[model samples]
Target: MKPSDLDPVVDALEAELRPYRDSHHTYRRLPSGGRDRREILDEMRELASREEAKWRAGYSSGAVYHGSADHIEFLNEVYAVNSQSNPLHPELWPSAVKYEAEVVAMTATMLGGGEEGVPTVCGTVTSGGTESILLAMRTYRDRARAERGVAEPEIVVPVSAHAAFDKAAHYFGMRLVPVPVGADWRADVAAAEDAVTKQTVALVASAPGFPHGVIDPVEELSELARRKGIGCHVDGCLGGFVLPWAERLGYPVPPFDFRLPGVTSMSADTHKFGYAAKGSSVVLYRSSELRRYQYYKTATWMGGLYYSPTFAGSRPGAISAEAWAAMLAFGEEGYTIATKALLETAAVIRAGIERIPELRVLGDPLWVIAFASEEIDVYAVMDQMSARGWNLNGLQHPPAAHICVTLRHAQPGVAQRFVADLEASVADVRHMPGSQGVMAPIYGMTGAVKTRGTVEELLARYGDLQFKA
Candidate 1:
């Protein structure tokens, strides 16, 4: 359905998204006179406190990766200390450079940099996973244009790859050729091989893709890229930090990093599983020469000679500092311990979902688990879960929902509680098949509508509503 056709639905959603409109003041304009500092602080605290319980109690998926109070307080203290510092002026705050360089080096080492058969994996810190992927794609596009004389570059991505690749293609003016996935939810290497053409500049793989949380065949895909003489970028934004420790703790993690000969670059998010605050990610390249393409320098500009790495010019050095502090605070031992708990909890949740006869898991995932019900509308089940305060990621094509297990979900009894609630949600869906909820009908309408532009318009309208005071 068109967005205008769903005005009532959007109105209902706006109420849920912006519930504080009734109780709190809407500030379309700044006050003529400044309010009391204490009053402002009290209002902010009240808003935060109201939303804290659901995530803290593991009712959400992937949003609050590490919500421990002490950890949060420590990060907040670190951010406050370096709040005014910006990486752009390195002379003023050389500590920002130190933090970012060390953050890159530490992340590189974790992802098999400076190891056997791998070139010096160097990279810059990006705002987040999307920025990281964008930079990587832009780097390949520029390099292909400069060296290979490829005027029109293309990227071969798995159907299950993150949408950031599509965003990268859109932003950087590159063609994205999508290949299908197999029954196991991993990328189809044969189809990827068939999709590669002379214009193809790079191939994309994912370490535990977001939808089904299954790693693509990086070994084979990267090998194909090597044979085809193209770059292979592994989207490890979701699983990079956790997988190394998971492999160390004896899990079945495939080789998806610089260890593979064909792997040219990678994107890993410190914010996701590294227990760092949001807004920081690392994009690594096989060598410095390839990474140099990602930099922007202008000596003939009206302003003084300047060079900026990554997309943003004056980035939050505080975020890099927080990422560095988070890594140091949670040393290898701490991360391993945390990954152990997360994977164990995920295993329990997976097994619980499997035991339910009505539903079946999409893949053999280690942490992020996706499940679908064959007997009932999975979206309705999602709404039922939402009614019980659970927030899950809804997927299309197969109509599934996933709960990305985080440190919060590893808390005592959270896994069991999730399983019980899930079973109850499935039962509710069975009892009332005709009853519809807010999100289910939206998903249903979006799927039924064949015109993609109409759905795009619907999403645009929702985005517009978010800014409606």
Candidate 2:
């Protein structure tokens, strides 16, 4: 009925989120004078050491893709050299331009950009995947309005597409026509075909979408868009860097990039599989004309004439430097080898989940694997896994849990440990029926509640709690 009614769950969440609140000093206000740099560094290192162990030991899902110590040190050095640089002021930081340009060019080439017969692909690096998707959607919206004289624009997307598309639709005043996925967990092409309308500006596809880690029917969906004379956007934020390598390693990766004539735009995260730092992603278009719509320029301002690309006028150039360095460091061979190991590790995990009688792997996934149970609460199983120090992603719609395999999982015994712990967690959940865990009841409540406004209030209260000093 109210957020207070869920006090027990909220309390547990607070304890987990605010572990350092009581142990560490809360910086409610700045001191009159700055503290010693060494003392500040010591405090920061203490926090970093505590948090780093979780992902370093392969306990997290998709957080640290390439967490090798040497690689991190390299990126840190690169970041340090360019820490003062901003891409917004290219005249002052020409190196930033070079870094960003190389990063985009490398990513585009990897995603079928410069191949013969394909259109010239161009793009800009952004803060992250959300911004990339936002830019692409805005590009489509503006392009449609300018070329087709369409005032109201729409996007036909599978329900499994990333929530960023929904966010873009909400932010840009466009409509998202939802289509259902088939039993294979791929987008239903027929449903998408039917969902398209005269006002539809684009169709959305995913190369291994987030929830179930299954690639959508991109060829069919893109062909449909081609026939309808609309743009098709393939969301590869999670899979872009990994999929090409996986394909070269002989995995069954589908065509889902610029090679598809109808796939006019794409968003890929350098932070995810490209092994860049946390703040970089690339949003690409088939032509410079389409990408120009994502830019902003105005000469009427009080200040000097201003023009900017992507959402932010000023962004850290160090991040782009890190991305460029990471790409060059890995190269094609390094990525192929890494992807092979990742997929192999994922295969082991997927096979282990299949062995567990209570659980079933949701879809045909390569690395990011989701599993669900028809016998018991998957959230309870997830909580049990949490008890064993495993951090996985919880999924709704059909009540599933996932562990996105990173390079950390390819370590010596991580995959084996995952399967063994998962089996033990399922057994624990089965033995203690109705022993609802902290997250299980919360998810149950969220799913059962018809009034979403109550859920939004609960989420807002949770957010407020996060800002508590």
Candidate 3:
């Protein structure tokens, strides 16, 4: 069947799931005029149990990190201890300030902040990686407007940078100049240099971009931005915690942090490889002066003085506390051990994928391994793996799938199972002639479509189904 034919099937499946979408924990008034907490708790627990398996067994990619029972319990305890704390009212919860400050400091140090005379790098705790990236972009935008009088600002970014950069550009009203990546999947520094103009506010480089897991040439790109008198934002959300330890473990890591003189700001997610609980990340600036541009303050408000360091006000202090606890609990030694396991597991997976006859690994990656096949449909293989109870990330432009090795994948027999299953999947695809799985057809249509508007409309319909309940 054609790819568009499967759209009806997908729409039907979405409609089927609509009834259960928002009915997971519906609150109804009781005859006794009180809610039933026990029933609600049971429903919530059931939902969690039903959804935990794929990620729990390490079949998924980079979603849940450090799923150990002890680690989760420790983080839960920390969060429970500070459940009532709010950073907005620092006087009420002084501990929030301490945790927030320490989290930023520890994250900065890990990302090569205080190595040299870097002037005690400062930052604020953000909600997540998107906020961190958004705040950095907004800071550059405002700083350029104030200092350089750049009204119509433009941000030079590699095509492989995170989608959040595009979100930042839209939110801050800045023009985004996307520089194409080279054959190696790294950003083209010369292309970025050519894209920059007087209205250019900042340049962006990613340390191991999300799609292909290739790091941009930060040293060259940042220097280009610096010479052009524009800001450079290094997106280390993926590699910030892992790469530092990977470098110390003697991996070939490029210079992609504040260590580069031209790197003015960076976004790193503590929730990711840092092993913190979700909803926590840090955005660091080269100096407090640059950070001030990211802050919001108003004295003319009807309510007294109001200020927010990052995007959100009255943020979840519990998540911040959990992030701090995770970092402190897993100090440098702990991170080093985790990083070693992750890198070693990634190496094993990479080698196994390379051994497969039909498949080729994309670029040279540490943990995130993207592989494509020349003999069989890669999406068909992905569907086969999915049927076998595995969840992997699908990539386009080259039609590949990736398995982001996390601690779960490092478990005994997990890597071997992945390789064995992948081999079986490829064999199945080779033998099954003219076969296209559900996603294969979809991806095929996506590739062949000339108008993106139709695809976007389909996406919007999918979103509507998600909220149909």
The candidates, ranked best first by TM-score, are 1, 2, 3
Off by over 4 Å in 3: 1-9, 12-34, 115-117, 441-450
Model 3 poorest ten-residue lDDT run = 441-450
Candidate 1 Cα deviation (angstroms), residue 106: 0.5
Q: lDDT of all predictions, in order shown?
A: 0.91, 0.90, 0.86
RMSD of 1: 1.3
* TM-score on alpha carbons, each prediction: 0.98, 0.97, 0.94
Residues 1-469, candidate 1: write the lDDT tens digits: 5546667777877888899988888999989999999999999999999999999999998998999999999999999999999999999999999999999988898988964345489899999999999999999999999999999899999999999999999988899999999999999999999999999999999998999999999999999999999999999999999999999999998898988889999999999998899999999999999999999999998989999998898899999999999999998999999999999999999999999999999988999999987798888888889899999998888888899999899999999999999999999989997655767756645334447777677678789998887
Model 1: CA > 4 A from native = 1-3, 115-119, 444-450
Query: In candidate 2, how many Å is residue 227 off?
Result: 1.1
lDDT, model 2: 0.90
Better TM-score candidate (1, 3): 1
What is the C-alpha lDDT profile of model 3 across 359-465, one tens digit per residue? Answer: 99988888888998778889889888987888888887778988888999989889989999999998888999556555554453443333566656556667776
Tens digits of per-residue lDDT, candidate 2, 1-469, equal 6656667767887897899988998888998899999999999999999999999999999989999999999999999999999988999999999999988888888898965435489899999999999999988999999999889999998999999999999999999999999888999999999999989999999998998899998889999999999999999999999999998988899898888888888999999999999999999989998889888999999998999998888899999999999999999998899899899999999999999999989879988899988998898898899899999988878888899999999999999999999999999989999756767755534433336676676677789898888
